[model samples]
Target: MAYLLSSERPAVAAASRNPLLAILRWAAKLRAERHQRLAFREMLEFDEARLEDLGLTRNDVLEAMGASAPQAGLHLQRRRALRSAIWLGRSSF
Candidate 1:
């Protein structure tokens, strides 16, 4: 039957019968999430002066690591505004 030959048919049939494959996929996803969390932790360990030298604040790093998309967008806008204001102030002196 044409239904049996459809591209979508084999993958679903194979996945349902293959428990090991499902487990491997889950493990890989978990590993990637752990790696991201560890990297965020290392960034947080940096001191304030060091973070400032990188043009980032603690809040910025934390938001980038864990916040939702909307929250991150707000933070980005606020950061840009602050930088613009600071630059204007410095130039006026």
Candidate 2:
């Protein structure tokens, strides 16, 4: 029983990591699609409810897409500022 439990631990950890990796991949795909100037209708094909289950709101997706737009220079600046703050906070050890 102990040996079996130990062997299952890595599988359990990998399983837990899968959802996070999936969300990251989905986000990357969504960002790439937005950057490619995909139509809103095409973007909407991505299941919003599934993204929501991953803790991302529609607004979050919109914001990410907006920030990624080349013409949205101001939004990109704000995102850089926010990202710097986040990294700063994480580094405050």
Candidate 3:
């Protein structure tokens, strides 16, 4: 009787049946964020010119580096995407 068109409907239903499954998913997500954060931290080694070439500034990297892993990744990604859309002329964004 419950017709669902969303792709995640099954996942949501399964998650309700097994609470620990949700915890494991959360842990996996955190681990992924940690890895992404480390990669972003490495960007700090780039000089201002190099960062600028990538459409990022030292302050942007510094700001992302200061946040939590997930937030930092989202912040950097969002900034880069915006830069690409505006500066790089990626109209598809």
Candidate 4:
């Protein structure tokens, strides 16, 4: 997974130029936010096979969908940490 960090001031100013795009972006963000919450709540019960049927790996779908920077940032960090932990565990073993 890749982590993207936009320069905050420029990013906001650029987004402010297009009202319609901004609204559409907001709607997409809302949808993704809802999905993330649902995913967390149902984490144990989630099915990877079904996600593939929907034509998406969880990460691909997430990047396509949209998310607030804070939420996305937290997720990125968590994923990085988990990957690091896995590597460390393998080395220890």
Q: Count the backbone clashes (under 3 Å) in each candidate.
A: 0, 0, 0, 0
> What is the C-alpha lDDT profile of model 3 across 10-87, one tens digit per residue?
655565457798788989998887787777777878888899788788788889878876588678778788888887
> How much lDDT does each candidate structure score?
0.68, 0.56, 0.78, 0.58
Error of 2 at 4 (Å): 60
Better model by TM-score: candidate 2 vs candidate 3: 3
Candidate 1's C-alpha runs over 4 A off are 1-17, 68-93
TM-score of 4: 0.40
Off by over 4 Å in 4: 1-13, 44-93
TM-score of every model? 0.49, 0.27, 0.55, 0.40
lDDT of 2 by residue, 1-93 (tens): 445664465555555357788799879878876655564334456687654444444554466566545544454345455555665685332
Candidate with the greatest TM-score versus the true structure: 3
Error of 4 at 3 (Å): 27
* Model 2 regions lying over 4 Å from their true place: 1-43, 69-93
Screening candidate 2 with a backbone cut-off below 3 angstroms (N, C-alpha, C), the clashing residue pairs are none
Q: Over all chains combined, what TM-score does candidate 2 have?
A: 0.27
Pairs in clash, predicted candidate 3: none
Error of model 2, residue 86, in angstroms: 16
